[model samples]
Target: MTVCEMCGKETEVFSAIIEGSELTVCAACGRFGKMLRKPVMRVVKKQAVEKAPGPVETVVTGFASLIRSAREKAGLTQKDFAMSLNEKESIVQKLENGAFVPPISLAKKLEKLLKIKLVEFEQEDEVSNEKRGSGPLTIGDILNVKK
Candidate 1:
């Protein structure tokens, strides 16, 4: 007969074996042994929360507004636009609402679908006005010499 160190019980046979050691335990002690055994798990779940917004939010805002305006002008709802792009409606909504940054591929697809350029540039009218005010000059003007 052997004794269980945990419950101070003696038994005819060892009820639990751990790390090359046998435990002689009564029925009540055996229940305690089962409790001590570790459970086998392949994966453990972890919870994640969304990160807080930062400086990039401003840039995303401009992109989101551009996408929203283009979609609206094209007469498509968020669901309709997302379906056309083979993407989730939530993704379109998030982009429209400035909740997420869109990948370049998505932006290019949007530009093609909407037929509107989304690139950032100086206002066309402002640029044209500047060009108009600048009088025509010859090659001599560029060389800083009068013909």
Candidate 2:
């Protein structure tokens, strides 16, 4: 049986919906996509639960540090990197100082512009924490939108 890349559910080959140019998601995640696309007012309760106490300050600090390290490794100053993202230098400075949280679209743009992989730390930790019987983790797992 083939597995749905988005939700990790098993499915037969013909039972998936193509989304964009990349994803072939199962029916549930396809419905999820539809829900996401709909206007906010029309939606009922969502399945995902928001975790209390958003990411710790340390995690934000670490993300900023990773951005700085990647930029430095690429031999680009904050100004140059910001210019590449069509963003302001001050914004880049703020991000490096953990004073801002970038949107996922911006994060993807930065990853492409800087040629760096910035993954979600909690997911990484969970994968490492599993001692046995855990299947190989995919990029989708690391980037899943956890509310």
Find the candidate with the highest TM-score and give its number. 2
Residue pairs with backbone atoms closer than 3 Å in model 1 (clashes): none
**How do the residues 1-147 of candidate 1 rate in per-residue lDDT, one tens digit apiece?**
555566776654344654455555555656644433422324777888844433221122387888888899889999999999999999999988888777767776777898766543332111223324367744544342326
Query: Candidate 2: which pairs clash?
Result: none
lDDT scores in order: 0.64, 0.64
Model 2 / residue 110 / CA error / Å:
1.3
Q: Which ten residues in a row have the lowest lDDT in candidate 2?
A: 33-42
Question: Tens digit of lDDT per residue, candidate 2, span 26-100?
Answer: 667766443223212234776987455344222233668888888899999988888888999998998888788
Q: Model 2, residue 84: displacement in angstroms? A: 0.7
